[model samples]
Target: MNTTTLLFEAPGPRGRRRCRLFEIISWAVLAGIAYLVIQTLDKRGAFDAAAWQPLGQLGVWRQLGVGLLNNVRAAVVGMLLSMFFGCFLGWGLLSGHKIVRYPCRAFTDLFNGIPVLLLLFFTSLALPAWGLPLTDFWFLVIALSLYSTAVIADLVRAGVQALPRGESEAAAALGFSGLQSMWLILLPQALRMMSPALVSQMVIVFKGTTLAFVLGGYFDLLRAATVLGAYYSRSLLQAQGIAAVAFMLINIALSQTAAAIDRRERRRYGVPPIGTGSRSPGMPE
Candidate 1:
C-alpha cells in the first residue's frame, strides 16, 4: 500500500470522519434545543427581571459552593470505603478455598442486585431504629460503598483472571506462599489492568450521591435544589435550571477527570494512547 493508504487504513480515516461528523451533529441538535427552551422561557416571562431576581439574590456562587461541598464529602468518603472493601472482597474471592470465596461472591452479588436509593433508605431508617448513628450523609456513603464495592470486586477478579498462568506458577516455584504470591506477583498487575474500571465505579458513586435527598438531609445538591424550589414555587423553572446546570457541570468534570486518569494509567503501563500511532495485540507495527 502507498504511504497515504497505509496510514489511512491503519487508523481508518473514514470511521474517524464519520465519528467527528456525528459528534458535531449531536452538539448542534443540543444547542438548537437549548436555544428553543430559553426562548420559550423568555416568552413566558420565566426569565424576566422579577422571575430571575430570586436566583440572582440567592448568590448563585454560595449555593453552588455548598452543593459542591456536600457532593464532594459524600463522594470522597464513599469512594475510599468502596475501594477498601472491594480490595478485601476481591482478595477473598481468589482465596482458593470455597468457604471463603463462595461467601464473598454471594455477598457481593446480593448487594449488587439492590438499587442504591432503596438501600440507602432502608439502611438509614433501619439502622437508626437499631441505635446506629446513621446520618443521611453516612447512610448515603454506606449505600454507595456497598453497591460500588461489589462492582469493583468483579472488576478486580476479571483483572486477576486476565494475567498469564505462568506468573502464578513462577511465584509458586520460587517458594512464595499463597498470600505472598498474591501480594508480590498478582495484585499489582491486576490493579493496573482494572484501573479504568475502578475509575468508572468512582464516577458512578459520585453521581449516586444525588440520591441522598431521600433521607431528608441538606447535604446533597438535589436536596438543596428541592428546598429552593419549594420556597420559590413561582420560580421553579429557574431553580430547576440551576440544579440541572450544577449536575451537568459535576458530571462533565467527573468524566473528564476519569478520562485523564485512564490516559495516565494507560501510559504508565506502556499501552499506546487511543487514536494515536499505536499497535494493538496481534497487529503489525
Candidate 2:
C-alpha cells in the first residue's frame, strides 16, 4: 500500500488497532443503551405477553387485515395514477413549445416541493370546501398520487434528458415525428433506465399510506395498531413496537426486491459497474 500522505496517511498497525477498539466501544455503548431501554420498557409493563394477546384474536386480526388491504389498495391506485400522469408531464417538460414545458415545469416544482403530509392535510380539509365531496380514502390517494407524480415526472425528465443525442438524431434522420420518436424510442429506454427509481418511489408511496391515520376516517396500519392498543390496558407501547417491526419488515422486503430487479436490469443492459453513491438521474439514494 502507498503510505505517502496526501490528506492523511493510511492507518499503521497502532492506528488500525485503535480503529478496531473504537468499533468495539461503539457496539458496547449501543448494546448498553438498548439494554437500558428494554429494562425501562419492561418496568412499564410493555413486555407483558398478555398485552400482545389481542393480536392473536380473530376479530383483531380481521380488522388489521382490512386495514392492510385498504392501505395496499390506496398505494396501488396511487402508484398507477402517478406513473400515468407523470409520464405525460415528463413529456410536456421536454416539449419544444414553451406553452407546454413551462406549465408542466411549474406544476411539478410546486407539488414536488410541498411536504407529502401537508398535501394530505390540504387535500383532506380543502377539497370538501371546494365541493369535491371526496371520501378520506380518495383524498389520501389523490394527495399521495399528486406528490408522487411530481417526483416521477422529474425522474422521467432527467432520464430522457440523459439519453444519447445519437438516438434522437437517428430518429430524425428516419423521418420520425418528435412524438413518435419519444413514444417509440426514448420513453421505453428511459423507463428501463429509471426502473429502480420508480420502484423506490413506489415504496415511498406505500409508506406514505400510514399518514392517512391522521385524517381519522382512513383505517390504515397505524390506525389499526392504535385500535388494538386501545383494547388492552397500557398496551400502546407493545402496539407501537409491533407496528414498527411490521413496517420495517415490509420495507426491507420491498427494498430487497427492488435491488434484485436493479441487478437483473443491469445485467440485461450490459451496463458497466458504478460506485455506491451513483444513482439514477434526479433520484436520491
Q: Relative to the unseen true structure, what is the C-alpha lDDT of residue 81 in candidate 1, on a scale of 0 to 100? A: 90
Q: Model 1, range 24-98, lDDT digits (tens) per residue?
A: 999999999999988997898886777767777656547756876898789989989988888789888887899
- TM per candidate comes to 0.78, 0.88
Off by over 4 Å in 2: 1-15, 272-285
Q: In model 1, which regions exceed 4 Å deviation?
A: 1-40, 58-60, 267-279, 283-285
Question: What does candidate 2's lDDT look like per residue over 89-173, in tens digits?
Answer: 9999999999999999999999999999999989988999999989999999999999999998888898888788999999999
Against the reference, the lDDT scores of all candidates come to 0.77, 0.84
Give candidate 1's error at residue 220 in angstroms: 1.1
What value does the lDDT take at residue 145 in candidate 1? Answer: 89
